[model samples]
Target: MSYAIGSVSSQDLWTRLKEQFSTVSRTSIFQMKSNLQTIKKRSDNVSQYLQKIKEARDYLSAAMVHFADEDIVILALIGLPPEYNTFQCMIRGRENVISLKEFRSQLLAEERIVETHVPNPLLSAMVADHSSATKGSTSPFQNNSSPSSFFSGGNRQFNHTKQKGRGKFNQGVKFNRQS
Candidate 1:
């Protein structure tokens, strides 16, 4: 080791050894960055997602790639699933930037809310029935006076409505008809 380093002292040799062992390649850095960008919150809780981000961020930091708290927040937001779009928008539209701790707390709260409100079948059915009943009377096709109306002349066969719920927030109710 000293032969290669040209008569380096023990401390210098130790430092050189540490540098050699700890050096990260550009490819490694790029790969870590890519992983950071693509790591998503699918089927994982907020804690898991945050842990992954922290790991990637720590790797980048070890490689001497620094990210500001704002950048970290943005990257974390990008890693979230499509369901978090509204939350992402809310964070982005904030007049004052929040700290990483605040962001984590907010994200965890939102995640909990999302988890709690997921598809209560009984409530969903009630909402669907209510919406359908309201729509039934107000449907333009229900006007028997209109020549183009399918409900005219008691032709109720063509007035069928199919309800399919995907159970994702406001999109939980779907109405389909076969013509």
Candidate 2:
């Protein structure tokens, strides 16, 4: 009876060690497979996000280009030619793009039109929930604070009576006034 019990115990230990060895040997391979799956899923998600971002940027840039042009954009916002017609900004070059910091000063120089308007009821409720997820913001338009500032100048003084066309001297851009 004692010999039978010893034999059974020895078999159990050997069986346990064999199972443990198998588990240990396979661990790194299984872990690598899991990690690869996770990495593939994350890569797919990032690709999707980047594609969406590119589309949005293309559309936004088209709109900004129309606005940046001397004639079409400023007129749409401020209203009428030959009055503010002479008041064009030289957005053609790359060098003079205004800083976001200076944007505050520029808008402040205008009226406080950059201040967020209360969104319509449907829009307002959406803003309320998502607003907490971000920093202190409540409007869709209030976050980036770009060309909105340019629209703030309410009562513009049209001192010059130039031609109702592109550039004060668009052809002779060199002579056109810059301040």
**All candidates' TM-scores?**
0.58, 0.15
Per-residue lDDT tens digits for candidate 1, residues 6-73, read 63587876676567537788898899889888888889899999999998987788678888889989
Give the lDDT of residue 58 in candidate 2.
34
RMSD of each: 13.5, 25.8
For lDDT, the strongest prediction is 1
- lDDT tens per residue, model 2, 49-105: 334433333333323321233322222223222222232232223365554344324
lDDT of 1: 0.77
**Which 10 residues in a row give candidate 1 its minimum summed lDDT?**
150-159
In order, the Cα lDDT scores of the candidates are 0.77, 0.38
Lowest summed lDDT window (length 10), candidate 2: 75-84
Cα displacement (angstroms), candidate 1, residue 94, comes to 0.4
Residue 37 in model 2: lDDT: 26
Segments in model 1 whose C-alpha atoms lie over 4 Å from true places = 1-17, 120-179
Residue 6 miss distance in model 2 (angstroms): 99
